[model samples]
Target: MIQASAGRDRIGRTARLGRLRVTKAGQALSEGVLVAVAVVAGVVVAVVAPAGIAVPAAHGAAAVSLLVRARTVAGRVGLRLTLSAISVAAGGLHYVLVDQMGAARHAAGVFPPVVRVLACVGIAACLGGAVAAMVMAATENGTTLIRLRRLLDGWLIAGSLFTVGWVLLLHRADRGGDGSASFLGLGRVVADILVFGLLVALRFCLPHAQRTATTVAVLALAALAAGDVLRILPSEPGAWDGIPLAAAGSLVGLFLVAVAPWLPGGVSVVGFNQRMMPVIGVVAAFVPVVFCALAIAAHTVAGGPIDTVMSALAGSVLLALGVRQGVIHADHLRITHESVVREDHYRTLVDRTSDVITIVSPDERVLYVSPAALWVYGYRPEDLVGARLPLYTHPDDRETLMQAVQILRQDAESDIRGPGRRVSCRVQGADGSWRHVESTINHHPDGLIFISRDVSERVAQQVQLEHLAFHDALTDLPNRALFADRVAHALRKRTTDEAPPVVLFMDLDGFKEVNDSAGHAAGDTVLRHAARRLRASVRAGDTVARLGGDEFAALLEWEAGAPPSSAKEVAERILTALTQPYPIGTMKAEVSASIGMAVAVPGITSDQLLHQADLAMYAAKAAGKGRIRLHHAEPPHAHRGTPNG
Candidate 1:
């Protein structure tokens, strides 16, 4: 980026500009300084010291820095403009003072031709400046560009007029109606005027790519025309000025080529033409340029007001035709407005009222999104508009979400509302960022209404809720309800092919003894350590449940064996793992599990399994403390002496 001070601005905005670097400041001061110089030089030359007239040139030289500084405030494009205007004034001074007014001192090597040379140089600079302005304007806003374009055309017209007027003055001075430089100059002037008009027409009609080419071609033809006019004229002192003017014009054309892309296509003029329009419109400019060149050639040779009048009249005709076309399209405009308004109003209600409103059509187009889209998901209404709504839906939840919507849409056929479905999705924003969102969709009488929210936080909260409901808060193991549920599911299976599942009921054998010897805190540690051992000892497919204080249950799926064998095998695994001493906070303590197992009967309830396991567990405790036991048909010989409950 250029220094802040180094860009374009108009008079009104110039004060708004802050400071900028020197290079960007180079555009405006030159000609305005020359203007002040000329007024003084003209008067001074006419008075006492004609030789001292070189002061004006010195002053003009000094003004360059000032102009550049001014341009910096205005920016590159605006600064170019001020330069162009100043150049035009310089060219006019050349015509009036050197050609007509007897302004410059005629002495030494400097001579009066110095003024003419300055004029030629000014014309060249002005043309370069205008081209630069146009290119910068191209990248600017429509409002800024439109005015810049008009100014460019006007500046070009001035160049042509000055060239034509200069020749006419020369003809008058030489006392020859000599059908020479004057007529050639008139032809060039008319041709340049035509070129200017054609440019304006092409600008509106053609695209940017074509405009660039057409601009070059028209400028080339203009140079050739100037050459033809100037070549025919004869001058007294040196080679004629006309040809050099034609050369200046050629250089001007080259300058335009350098500057054109920077105009509307550059940083300034945004939204000047839609991207596609510029691509196509450029090609169309050539045809108009050719016709205009031809008209100028014809106008130049014919030597009448007919060409000028015809061009003006044609512009009027086009204006009138455009007015008529507007009248014809008025009804279409009304219809377009009505359709858009209806849709907009419907969308507006959804945008305002809902936390996240989405109107998804049956066909899958995202017809509308709400204002809450911004808060719920970092997306604007436009980003989702026409994007498929379901594309954002989480893949794992899609089937369930779609199924629910389908059912609702079907219900709408009867009642306009089915059971609502919650779908979790993510929405992408205009900035290409995403946010997690959940939506509840309903089929409205017209189409569909979806209310959505950013539920990422809520989803985390729900996960915590589910965890609390099913697990031990401290040890993070399955609680009694979950443990019972696992056993219940295992027992509920009606296994016709394989063995029934086994349940292992466990009580930490030495837990109370440890609690009495150690602190209550130490006892809690033993309970937690025992749970961990039970969990680690069991297979991944087995369920390890903490059944309140000091008691635990495990459900094991039977593979190819009877339930008693697998139950005994798993109980042994738990007992072995629990024997490893646990470091309870400060002290190490050893413990064992007194486990009872039940190989479930087919179609038996979970409560039956629990009762049998409890009975077996008590028997194991009596038999030896840590070894597992199985339920016998009635009772073991050792337990035969015991009373029935």
Candidate 2:
């Protein structure tokens, strides 16, 4: 009930804060009082009719409910006054019209058929309008207004146009019709028609919220009205047919931009879920459906009805349905595309599994190697993918590795090969370190699939195992087994096609004294140093292998121009390398050797050469501790010894 001056403009509201501005309790009392009044009026009329009152007692209760809703919804904004004014005026207007028409018009018993028909038409329009208001509220989704800087001042212009035009029409009317049919009456009718048409045209030309193409449609309607107005005599009222047409077109335009009940249920459902509700779907949907139904019913109630209203509604329904179907199709296509994309993503992940995987041609050439190549050989997956297996095999082992793959590739009849066939050999690494690998091969369609582990650590372990099998663990010079293996390898490399070289075997002299006095720690130091010196003295191609208990041996080949006494030169080199004093903790010790040399003849076997070498070495030891001897050619007795100078 707080009334304040909004502005001087009449459209701008003013509020009154006195007794006239009713409080809620006061308003509620008014409604209750009005309903009571209406009910009493109905009952009184039922018993003894009022000569003046005709609109029913029931309406009084309805007006109270309408006033309560309007006041509650429009609590502070001057909309409360607006709603109150609109609702009360509407209700009061109904009461006045009904009262003047006579109460008997409502009952079948009293009024003539034409009077009853007229009353029925009025009731239907009022009811239709009320129902339409409800739908309109929902479709607007409570969005009564958007914030605007200001309203246009075009209303004055429209009023002026209407006024000036009416005055002109009135003067004409006075000139044509009798002066008794004065300008006043003529001006009033002309003004009413002109006001409606001008407002329609003006609102159209300056479209605000052009919902349902209202502005354009209103202008079209104004044009039709203008045509009819021109046809009418100024003294008479203009025909009213343009009102319905113009209103229908305005509604149609409003329906297009305004959210209407004509849309699908799902549209409303999702619209409700958006963070901000753009449109209230359920409300929008109800508006148009109910609107069409009401219009159809109203038209049918109009004398025998017509196709015009039905056609407008049917066209709207068809357009809405078409738009709905298009949205559904778009959604379906998007889902299908997404599903295919997900499937492709899943497939790619499976193809690049972490396990060491390779595809090979039946011919044993590598077709593809998985990313696990880096894990096995320190090479990128791509480095080995198309490279031949022989490329990764050790130079000494490549011949055999290639042969194995060739066998698989050549065998067209077999599709399966060894699943657990292990080949132990050196594999090449990108860093030039030898990768000790154990490869297991499987025959595939195009080649053999070889999965290998860079068992370098394992190889070092295996070497350790072999060294433990043959040599002293503490010194790691050469295990006896490995010494034996190297001897055998050297012997195997020589044959009738290649002459065998000399084998020199030497055992350290006085190394036991260092161990017994300085401890095994010093003894180990002496042994390791001795091994290093022996390795340094030999040519890069020579084989130096250790025998247990500070015993060592060497192999040297005799080239075409080499000295016939090459063994003497090797003995000298060994002596010189060993003569250097070594530091073992607090003690320094000079170490020497009792060396034995035995030449394997052009076709002599390794067993014969080693036995002769041993006998010569024993002979040199018997001759003197620090000495060298040769045993070969003339059986076991052709022995010679030379003491270091």
Whole-model Cα lDDT of every candidate shown, in order = 0.55, 0.50
Error of 2 at 373 (Å): 6.4
lDDT of 1 by residue, 417-496 (tens): 33566667665545655556777777765567888776667777988999999998767889888888888876666466
Candidate 1 has its poorest 10 consecutive residues by lDDT at 3-12
Worst 10 residues of 2 by lDDT: 144-153
Candidate 1, residue 213: the lDDT equals 34
Pick the lDDT winner.
1
TM-score for each model: 0.41, 0.36
lDDT of 2 at 406: 50
Supply the global lDDT for candidate 2: 0.50
Q: Model 2 misses residue 270 by how many Å?
A: 51
The all-Cα superposition gives candidate 2 an RMSD in Å to the true structure of 28.3
* Tens-place lDDT digits, model 2, residues 46-127: 2343323322332343345444434534322223223323432343344344334443433564444454344345444443
lDDT, model 1, position 390: 65
